[model samples]
Structure formats: C-alpha cells, structure tokens
Target: MTTLTLNAALHLDDFSLEVDEQIPLQAITALFGASGAGKTTLLRIVSGLHREAKARIALNGEVWQDSDNGIFVPPHLRSAGYIFQDIRLFSHLTVAGNLEFGRRRAAAGDGPALEDVIRIFDLKSLLQRAPDSLSGGELQRVSIARALLRNPTLLLMDEPLSALDARRKSEILPYIEKLPERFGLPVLYVTHNVDEVARLASRIVLLSQGRVIAHGDATEVLARTDLKPLADHLDPGAVLEATVIEHRGGMATLGVGTQRLRVPGISVESGIDVRIRIQARDVALAIQQPQGLSIRNVLDARILKIEHYGEILAEVLLDVGGQQLRSSITREAAEELHLQQDIAVYALIKSVAIDVGLAG
Candidate 1:
C-alpha cells in the first residue's frame, strides 16, 4: 500500500504544529480537527507551499521536502492538486477557459485527459457557463475538475465545503465521495466537521492543538470517547458498515454484521453497501428486549465499557454482533439499570435517528 509520510515541527506566534505520521494513500484521508489545529498549515507543508526547518515530507517513497538535505520541491513542481475553501476560478474566463488553463499546466505523468476530466466531474453542461453564474456546489465541482485536469499524484482540499450552506454541501458531497476511485489519486482532506469526516474519510488523522491525537480507521477513531473533549461540539456517534438486505414498506433492512437494522428513507437498491451513523444520544439501553414498541430497530449488545463525562452524562461502549455501538445516557439511568461492563443488554434506535450514506 502507498503512504504519505510527514515529520515536521512549526511554531507560530501563538500556535505550533508538530506532526509525525504515515497516512495510507487510499480513498480519502481526513485531517480532522477544530479551527487553528494546523490542519491547513499541515496541508500547506505537504503541498510545498510552507516549509519547516528540518521538516521531511514524502509520498510513496518520493521525497517532496527534506529541509536538512537542502532538498525542497516547489509547489508547482510537486504533483499536488490543491482546492482551497474559496473556489479560485478565474472570474474573467468561462468555465471552459478555466479548465483549459488547468489542462495547460498538466504534468507529464499519466493525468486524465480533458474529456475524461469533464466526464468524471459531470461538468459537460457547465463548461460553457461562467464561474459567477454557477451555484456553490457547481463551482466546487468545476474547481475539482480543474484540479484533476493537472493530473496530480494526490489532492489536497482545505475545507472545500466550509463556505457552503447545508444544502449545497449535501449537493456536492456525492461527487467528492467518488474522487479517489474515479480519479485514482489520494486525497488529503482537511475538515473540522465530523459528519464530513465520517461520510468521506476512510482513514482519519485527528489533530488537536497542532498534534496528532489519533489516527486510524474512521469508525474506530470517531467512536473513541477519549477524543470527546475535542469533538464535544460535534455529534458523538458510531459509524457502522452495513449491507442492504431488502426493502419493504418504504423502509430498508440493513445487515450490520449478524444483526439487522431497518431504516427509513434509504433509497439505495438492495445488496448495496452503506455506512450508517448512530448517534450516541439517540440510543437507549434496555436490560431486556422490549416488546410492542414503535421502535423498529433493536440489537443484542454487550457492554464493553462505560465512561462518565461532564456531570449528568455517561457514554457506554457496546459490542453488537462484533461491531461497536455507543450510547449516551444520563448518569442516573446508568445507576438505575446497574449497567456495567460485560453485561448483556438491548440497544434501541429510532429509524429516523440514523444517518445513512454510501460507503467508499
């Protein structure tokens, strides 16, 4: 497997970034953290736009920067396609003209041809339009298409959706989700939104205060209670890999490991793979499986661990058919139910509480 290695130390007036990590080059690797966590700064270092003393950056054995050896490749020299928060298309030119500019700067490597780039990004209809006439989602799509036209070895995106509203963000996510498979390039995406990370990232390099606090599979990293304080502002949830079993009565049955979950509003056809996010706050635990309830989803689970956060809340980790599930409950409920590690329980979930998306 290919990997990107970064070892660097940078100090600013009030913030400093120190990271030493080897991230796998597959799908999307999210550099996730709150603002000022040096996510963009780290991305810049990798893009050869920012340099640190004695910093070392390499991708799949190709060294981009090694400060000690006086080896540093310029941003333009390195095959990195960068898409910033602002869609930096040339306002003076039509969308086709802007894309042609990217095609002109193409590297000698095996990059996508102009026609293939247009097809991949679904930009054929918008090619003749002006940048200002496009919507936020459309602009980003064109931006991504222009970036891919350069045929970079990897892609760097710094909060590409941060500026868009919820609707536009949703409008463009499906396209971004298909980048790695569609373009055959590794993407280092930086975002603070856990939802984006959960939806798009296969590997997560979680940063905090300019340091890497955790790095691994997206499901494992996001379910960790230890990272709660950093992500407390975001929703706490467990990401499960499930397969569509069948559709019946407007709901879809998804198989999570050996268990089954029935969710509503799943439009995908049966037999497709999907990722579902179950928020801890939406899960309720029962000592026994309850009957005659309106809830349609319940799974056999065993308590893996319990952690108390703040004063009134507790986060319980559970083993449900070999996959992890989390529940956030009041401390009073934990004491009342006598919940403890290794105890058998039932996990109740509402069909509407589940967030479903296509898995990469």
Candidate 2:
C-alpha cells in the first residue's frame, strides 16, 4: 500500500505542533480540524514549505526530508501540487497560458497531457479568458487544471472550497470528486466543513490542538462520540454508500445493502453509485414497524451499541442489513423503548432529511 509518513515537531510563538503518524495514501484523505488546529501547517510540512528540526517525511519510500540524515528536499523538488484557499491563477495570463506554465514545470513524463487535463476540467472554452474575468468557481477549475498539468503525484488542497459561496462550492465539488478516479492521484484535502468530508473523503484524519485525535475510515471516524465536541456544531452524521436503482414519482430509489431507501429526487441517472449522509439527529427509532405513517423509509435494524452523550441525548448504533446507521435520540425515549444491545428495532428516516447536495 502507498503511504506517507511524517514525524515532526514545530514550536510557534504560542503553540507547538507535533505529528507522528503514517497516513495511508487513498484516493482522498481528509485532514480535518478547526482553526489553529494545524491543518494548514501539516499541509505545509508535507509540501516542504515548513521545516522541523527532527522532521522525517517520506512518500512511498521516497525521502523528502530527514533531519537526522542531513537531507532535505526543497518544495519545488517534491512532486506535490498545492492548492490554497485563494485561486492563485496569474491575473496577467490567460487560462491556457497558466496551464502551459504548469505543464512546463512538470517533470518529464510525470502526468497527463495538457489537452486531456483541459478536457477533464472542461476548460476548453475558457482558454483565452483571463483569470480576472472568470467566476470564483471557474477560477478554481482553472487552478485545479493547472495543478493536474503539473503531473503531481500528491495533491494538497487547503480548504479549496472555503472561499466560495454555497452555489460556487456546489459547482466545483463534482469536479473535485472526480479527481482521484480520473487521474489515480492521491489527495490530501484540508477542510473544516463536515459536509465536504462526508462527500469526498475515503479516509479521514481528525486533528485537534495540533494533535491527531482520530484517523480511520470516514464513516467510523464520524460516528465516534469521542469526537462529538469537535463536530457537534456540524451535527455529526453517518455516510452511507448506496447505488441508484430507479427514479419515479419525483423520488429516487437507492439500494443500501439488501434494503431499499426512498429519497428526495436526485438528478443522476440510474445505476450510478452515490454517497449519502444522514445526520444522527434526523434519524428516529421505533420499537415495531409502523403501519400508517408519512415517513417513507423504515428499515429493520438491530441495536449494536448505545452511547449516552449527556443526561438527555444518546446515540444508538444499529446494524441495518449489515450496514451501520446511527440515530440520536433523547435518553428518555431510549429508556422508554427499552433500547439495548442485540435488540431488534426499526429506523425511521424522513425523505427530506437526506442531504442530496453532499451526494457524490
């Protein structure tokens, strides 16, 4: 398996950052944390922009830095494409010119052809347009195209969508989701947005106070109550991978394991796999399957574990046809329903609660 290892420590004026971990290079690995948590600092360290005295950084056996060995490869020498929050396109250059500049700096036979990247990013029409004339979303597309033209082995994105408004973010997210599959490149994405992590991240690294608090599959990491304080503001949720089976009567049918779910209308065609996010609070548990109800989705599930967040709220983990589903409810409700491990129950999800915007 491809991996990136970093063992480093840095002391700032008010805080110290220490990172010692081996990150598996998946299609997209999210570096998630709030402000001042060293998310950007870690990205800088990986890109060789920042250095630590005892740092040792390596990617797939290639040593980029080793303080003990007296070896340090500069930022430009590393095959990494760094995209900042700001769209750093050259204002004086046309879109094509910027892309050409990246192609020129690429290592010999490193990445895709310029024309291919342009096509993938749908930048053909914007070739002659100047950066200043492009919209925020369009500028981001151009910047990403330029990075691809550079033939980077590892792509580092530091809150690439944070600068854009909601509409612009929605416009660029589909493109970002395609990067890993289109180029087979490993990406380290830094973001505080839980929705983005749910949509794009295959693996996640949770950071707090410059330390890695959790790292694992995106679903598992999000479900842990230990990270509740970190993500409570976002209304922590679970991500489910499902396939679109059919669409009719303004509703889309999705297959999750052996069970079927009806959700709000989705634009994608049938047979396309999608990732769905359901907030824990949006799910409700039932002791017996209901007969008449407005709710459309009711899946049979068995209780796996129950965790009390505080005196009033609790998070229940349920096994739904072999897939995990989380439901957050009042402690009184859980006790009234006699919720316990190995007990069978039903999960009721409202169709509107399913966030289709985060689907990918």
RMSD of 1: 15.4
Question: For residues 72-171, could you state the per-residue lDDT of candidate 1 as single tens digits?
Answer: 9999998899998998999999999999988899989777888888887788999899998999888998999999988898999999999899889977
Question: 137-228 in candidate 2: lDDT tens per residue?
Answer: 99999999898889888999999999999999989998999898999889999999887887799999998888899999987787564464
Local distance difference test, candidate 1 = 0.85
- The TM-score, computed over Cα atoms with residue i paired to residue i, of candidate 1 is 0.68
TM-score of 2: 0.69
lDDT of 1 at 161: 98
